[model samples]
Structures are given as C-alpha cells and as structure tokens.
Target chain A: MKTVKVGLGTCGISAGGEKVYKAFQDELKENPNAFVLKETGCIGMCYSEVLIEIKNGSDESVFYSEVTPDRVGEIVEKAILSDDTIEEWLAVKPDNKQNFIDNQTRIVLRNCGIIDPGSIDEYIERGGYEGAKKALTTMTSEDVIDDVIKSGLKGRGGGGFPTGVKWNFTRGAKGDKKYIICNADEGDPGAFMDRSILEGDPNAVLEGMIIAGYAIGSDAAYIYCRAEYPKAIARLRQAIAQAKKKNFLGDNIFGTNFTFNIKIKEGAGALVCGEETALIASIEGKRGMPKFRPPFPAISGLWEKPTNINNVETFANVPWIILNGGDAYAAYGTEDSKGTKVFAMAGKV
Target chain B: MSQQQSDNFKPFNVDLWKYDGQEGALIPLLQSAQDTYGYISEKAIDYISHITGIPAADIYGVVTFYAQFRTKPLGKYVVKVCNGTACHVNGAKPIGDTITDELNIDYDETSDDGKFSLLSVACIGCCSLAPVILINDETYGRLTSPKLRKILRQYKRKVKEEK
Candidate 1:
C-alpha cells in the first residue's frame, strides 16, 4: 500500500491544506488500506502549499504540489495507488523542475517536512532527544558550554549574539536562580522559520532547551511564543507532556542529578515583546513594551531572576550541535557565522 | 455582570488558572477576554480584573499599547492586510488603501453594513507570498488591483446572498 504525507502547516492550511487533507480522508474512508495518509509541516515551499508526497512503500516518491480539494480524487487514484505517476500535478517532475532541496544543508529543519510532527516516535527514530541524553549522561555543564562555544553558532535572531558566550554569562552569573527562555515569539513579520520549526519539530527545540537548561544550571524555563499559532502551541503542549512521560524532561532527567522543566507562555500579540527585557515583562504579566537594560535578561530577568534567552532557531540548532560535536557544526558556515540559516522565504523569492 | 459579559466569560474561568499570580498573565487574560467577546468590552476588562486582579486602567494601557486589541466590536469578516517589510517592498500600502476604499471605511473600521472590517497586520510570516491580504483564515497573495476588487466584490456578494 502507498502512503501519502500532506503538508498541514498554517501556510498549507491557509491555502486549502485542510480541504485537501479532508478530501483524502473522505476518499480513504471509501477506499481504505489503499493509501496511508499522514500529515507533515511545511517544507519551506509556502508558495505551493497543500503539498502531498506519495510513497509507494519503496524508493519511488512523487510530491504533488498546489493540490486543491477538487483535484484530490484524481491525484490519489492516478498517482498514489496506480503505477503511472501524474506528471502535471507533480511539484518537481523527473528531469524537469529544479529540485529546491539541492545544495542546501538543512540541520535545523532536518526532520521538518519529512516526518509526522504529531508523532514523537518519528522524532526519536530520527535521533531526536539523543543530544539531551549525550549532554546529560557524559558532558558536564562547563563542557556543554565549552562545546557550544567551540561550535561558533551566532544567534539567528538577527542580533547575532554568540549563543555559547551568552550561555556562559548566564551560567557564571551570581544568582541563586537562573532561567532559560526560548524566544519562540517570531514577532518579526518575515521570520516564519521559527514558527515552522516549532510546528515541524517541537521535540528538537525541547531537546535543545533541555541541553541549555543543563548547561546553564536552570531548573525551569518557558517558551515565550505566539498564541496565534494554535497548531504549533498545541503540538508544543503535547511535546512537553510527552517529554515528561518519557523522562526526557522533569526532575533528574535522563537519570542524572540535574533536573529541569519547561513551560509555555502564550505571547498575546505584541511585536515589542520579542525583545528580551520586554519578553520577560510580558511573561511576568505586564505590557509588552521594551525597556532599558542596565541589567540585561542574562544578569536579571523573569521576576528578577537571572535568565538566559535565545531565539528559536538558536535553540533549535542545539541538539544537533550536542549530538554531532561542536566542530562538526562549526564546519558548516563562515568564520563570522556558523551553521544553517532557515529564512522564511516569503515574498517574491 | 451583564448577560453578554457572563456569556463570554465562561470559557476563560477555568483556563485563567494557568496564568494565576503571574504578572504576565494580564496580557494573555486580556487576549482571551478579547477572543471570548468579539472585542474587549468595558465589562470584559472588569471581569478579567475580578479574576486576575489586574487593574482596569493597566489593562486599558496594555490594550491601547498593542494594536491587536479591539475596544469596539468587529465585522463578521476581518480583512487583515500584511504591512511587513516584504509587503511594503511589494506595494502593500496601495493594497491596504484599496481595501479601505473598497470597504467604504478607514483602516480598523467596519463597514456601515456590518459585513466587513479592514485592518492592517504586521508580517504574518508569509513573505514568500508578499502583498498578501488575509480574509479571516484564508490568504489571498500575489494579488493585483483587479483581483483585489473582485475579491472584495465576492465578499459583498456572499453576504448579500446569505441575507
């Protein structure tokens, strides 16, 4: 039996991904066991949403793009279950369309568009929390920080702050309690990469947070994110619950002395709150306004507790860095910057 | 409490606990309150204040600070135009202007017939589809002048047909 994977991210849903999914569902109900339908997040091709890939349980796969609910029946019958592939509907036809994935190294978005984000098992099968395990079981807090520094990853959030150095500052700060925050509030209108990452791979970000918490000596952390992203928010809530049940999160995680927990604080539609100090205030239940920082979030933040804040893409890169030595990650980018940059690819690109 | 306020306040009573005592809970509470009611009513603010203990004045400051908050009721259909960098580069101002013109109201104002509301939103991250306008959940991107007019007319026609 052939299996079908539909891109159901917000972009996809907005462009009738839900209708296409429903159409497939309606068709599958009548003709069960012919095709296995699964949903994946956007693969960065927002232009061609309502995308679906049909796999014939073998090496062959055809990605049908720009698919509408009206066209679902024909695509399923002709392309998915049958031997002949529909060239017209295929987003990238053999020996025709330029393969967009070519010459692009996708680390942060490795599992994205490739797996069922709703399924944590798929994340694990693709080596999800193994970075947390490696960090917890073998590496010390200092070592983790050192390895991160060696990786040479600057923040992808446009500030370009060196992540390891920031982590080190928080780690060494003179405070009784320190907190780590994943700034998932991709408030900048153009930066959909963070939201896409969260929607596609919540565990990777969660794992990254676990590693950061262990390194920074924080017991608790919160992801300050947009509530507008209901799907991503729902997935994250589920991922957090699953992590605790699987012992990937919670006290003494991975059977180590270190303990950590993460919470999700829904950002209530404020762009200014994307700034670190403002984010802290918003999390503290105040107006999302920027503030002057003599004491940056690193020194004093989140109810006057020392907090380390990193952007979504920054933390999203953590598990990969920890799993594959920092040097391996360092090898990808220039001297000034390191690793992949996941641009949202919006507008007239 | 007024009947309208009480009706809208039901969904948030249980959910507000997750944010209890957290100073930052105010914004999310206000947001939830806004979601419950089409707009943030005076009673809604008081209802939120009663539950979360945040002052109505402070809530008003927060609501006013952010553009997302709507003190007044909205139309049945909300047309959110993207005014982010990419959209700006792609002539979003004219698109926004066209929307305001077509709707026969200014930005953030609903039509006289109460069928459509026009608003400008920050980049919704669909940059690839610049010059995009979201009508409710559906996004119409790469739009042109004629297309925009046609889309507007369709909305009007749909409302008329329903009536």
Candidate 2:
C-alpha cells in the first residue's frame, strides 16, 4: 500500500500541519486503509513547512511543500489515488531546494523527516540501537573510548573538547558514582537544531547516552531539556518509554552486567542554563548560576560527583560514529573538524 | 488567605503534594503551579514557599530570574512576539510595534480592557517563519504590519463575539 507522511515538527505544526493532516484524514475516510498516514519530524526544509511526502510502494516518492488544508483534496486525488505527481508543488523538483538537499551529507539527521519518531519498531528497523548493543556486548570501555578518539568527534556545543577524552576523564576520576548528562537546553537564539534532533530522532541520542554510560562506568543519565519545546519533551518521553519496554534502556541492558537509566529534567526557561555549570546547577534545583570551572564536570560535578556532559547534537552523532566506524565519520569536514554539523540557516537566507 | 483566592489555586495545591520531598523539584513544581493558575500569584508563591520551605524572597528571585515566569495575571490573549536574531533581522520590531499600537498598549503591558497582553520573547525557535508572534499556543508568522493588524482585529472580534 501507499503511505502519506506529514511533517509535524514545531515548525510544521506552527504552519498548520495539524490542519492539513486532519484534512487528509477526512478525505481518506472514504477508503480507509487505502493509504497510510504517518507523522514525522522536521526535514530541515522548515521554510517550506507543512511538508507532505507520498510514498508509492518502495521505489517512488513525491515531496510536496508549502501545503495547505485546501491542497489536501487535490493531493489525495492526484498523488494518492491517481498516482500523478504535483509538479508545481514539488520540493525536490525545484532546482534550488533540490540542490540544497543534494549538496550535503546527513548523518545526525539520517532518520529525521523519514521515520515515525513515536514508533520504536520503525527506529529499530532502520538500525537504531545496534551501536549501543555492540558497545555493551562486544567492545570494551577502553575500546569504545579509543574508537571515539580516533573518529575525532568533538563537543558540538561550541567548546570543541574531544568526546573520548572527556569520557576518559570521568572514567579515570576517583568517584563511587558518576553521571552522564545530555544538555538539551538549546537557549541560543536562531538555533533549533537541538530541538529538531530531540523531536526527530530521540532514540539516537538515548542510544548514544547508553553507550556513553557504559564507556564511563556510569549507570545514571539525565537529559536536561528546556520546557519551551513541549513537543520535543513529549517525543523524548515516548521514545524513552518505548526504549525501556524493549530492554534498550534500564537495568542489565542487552543481557550484560552493565546497567543504565535515563531521566528527563525539564528546564524552567532559563537561557543561562545552556552553560554547562548553570545547566548542572539547574538540574540540582538550585538557581542556575555558573561558578569557576577548575574542577570541570568530568572531575566533580552534579552533587560533587564525577559527571560527563555532552550536547544533544554531540550525543546524536555518537551512535552513527560507533556504527559506521570513526574513520568513516572523520572523512567529512576539515582536518580540524570531523563529520557534519546541522545549522539553523535562518535569517534572510 | 481568602477562600475564593485559595479556591482559584485549589488544583495547584492538590498537585503540589507529589513533589514534597523530591530534590530539585522546586522549579518544576513552580512551573506546574503557574500552569494551573495563569500566573504565579502572591498567594501561590506563599503557598509554594510554605510547602517547599524555600524562602519567599528566594522564590521571588527565581520567579524574576527566568523570563518564562509571569508574576502578574495575564490578559485573555498573551501575544509573545519573537525577538530572535532572524526575527529581528526580518523586522520583528515593526510587528511588535503594530500590535502595541493596535491594542493601545506598550510592550509587556496589557490593555485596560484586559483582552490582550503584549510580551517580547527571546525566540520561539521558529526562525524560518521569522517575525512570528504566539498568541497563546497558536503561532502567527511571516507577519507584516497589515497582516498583524488584521490578526489583532480577529482576536478583538473573538472577544466581541464572546461578549
């Protein structure tokens, strides 16, 4: 059968994606189960939101942009029932937009705008948690750290600290208990990539954290997400519950002695909490204020215990790096910076 | 406290019991209290401070520190104009100016009629739809002065129709 996917990210929803989805639902009621309707995250073509993609079997797909509720009838008639592509409404058929998608590599956003974020089955079908399983069952902690170091992945949170080296510090630190934190407090203006990743493919970040916990000998982790993005939080909650049900999270993961748990701490709309120290302080229920960082979070952080914190984008890249090997990731970008980075590309552009 | 005042925030008190002993629960708890009641009232603050044992002064500090926390009761429609970099570049100020002019209220001020309140926010993360304003949870984006004026009129029409 054919499937109709609607982009329902914050950008899409703000553009009346829900109305369009509802319109399609009303239209499809006549022949129920004739075509499947699915919800997906932002495709990064947010400027042309309310994006609708019609997939005819496996080989052919048509992308329509700037869609409205009025267009749904014609779309259902032409694209779904009649199997005719809407040439004028095509996002890929347009030269500039198609070039935009053609000229870039997408590792972190591989699953975004494609799969159903709420469905763990869709995620697993696309090879989601294999990296975490591989890291836990096959690779040693030192080996995983070495592979990450070799891959040249740095903190995408603007600090540019090496991920493996940071993990090693927590690993070497003298502490009875250590913690891992995923900083989803994307407070910077004009940046919604973190929100998109959390909404689009939360499991990638979760899997990355599970691997990080195993690597750094920490069993507990927290995702410090801002409360502004309610959709992202809701999606993360769904993803975590699904992951736990499938034994992808929680105690004794992957039938190994390793145990890890992930929790979400909603931020109370403080932009300063985007900073590492301020974020840690916010998570601890104190007023989010930054102190000196001589003893970095890797040494003594989060209740004065050893802690490892990485950005949402940083963690989202981890599973890809683990599955595809560090060398494959290192091949992209400049000699100094490895892999790809997602940008907001907002403003007059 | 007056019975009516406490009754206004009865649900907050009922839900506030769960976070009694949980560490780092103050902010989330306060957030829920605000969500239950439109804004964090003085009585709500006192009740929260009494229950959490955090000083009223400290609670006020937290409430004032964060931009999202509203101390006063909101107008029926709270219009949040985005002031992010992209929105600023794309003339977010004129959009704000248009709303305030149409409503006859300044930024962060509510109308005398209590129908609308104008507020400036850092970003709503919808830069692609720059020059955006969120009236309640509904976002109106890519706005010009005329477009915004029309939106404000529609909201005013909503108020009139209700009356």
Note the DockQ of each predicted structure.
0.52, 0.67
TM-score of chain A of each: 0.97, 0.98
Q: Give the per-residue lDDT of model 2 (tens digit) for B2-30.
A: 13224455535445546757777777877
lDDT of each residue in A179-267, candidate 1, tens digit only? 99999888776778888999888998999999999999999999988766777898899899988899888877888888899988887
- Where model 1 places Cα greater than 4 Å from the true spot, the runs are A96-98, B1-19, B50-53, B113-115, B144-163
lDDT of 2 by residue, A84-184 (tens): 88899987785565466668789999899999889989989999999998899899999999989989999998899999999999999999999999999
lDDT of 1: 0.84
Clash pairs (backbone) in predicted model 1? A189-B123, A284-B23, A284-B24, A285-B23, A285-B24, A285-B25, A346-B127, A346-B128, A347-B127, A347-B128
Worst 10 residues of 2 chain A by lDDT: A94-103
Q: For candidate 2, report its TM-score.
A: 0.95
Fnat for each model: 0.61, 0.64
Per-model TM-score on C-alpha atoms: 0.91, 0.95
In model 1, how large is the Cα lDDT of residue B157?
92
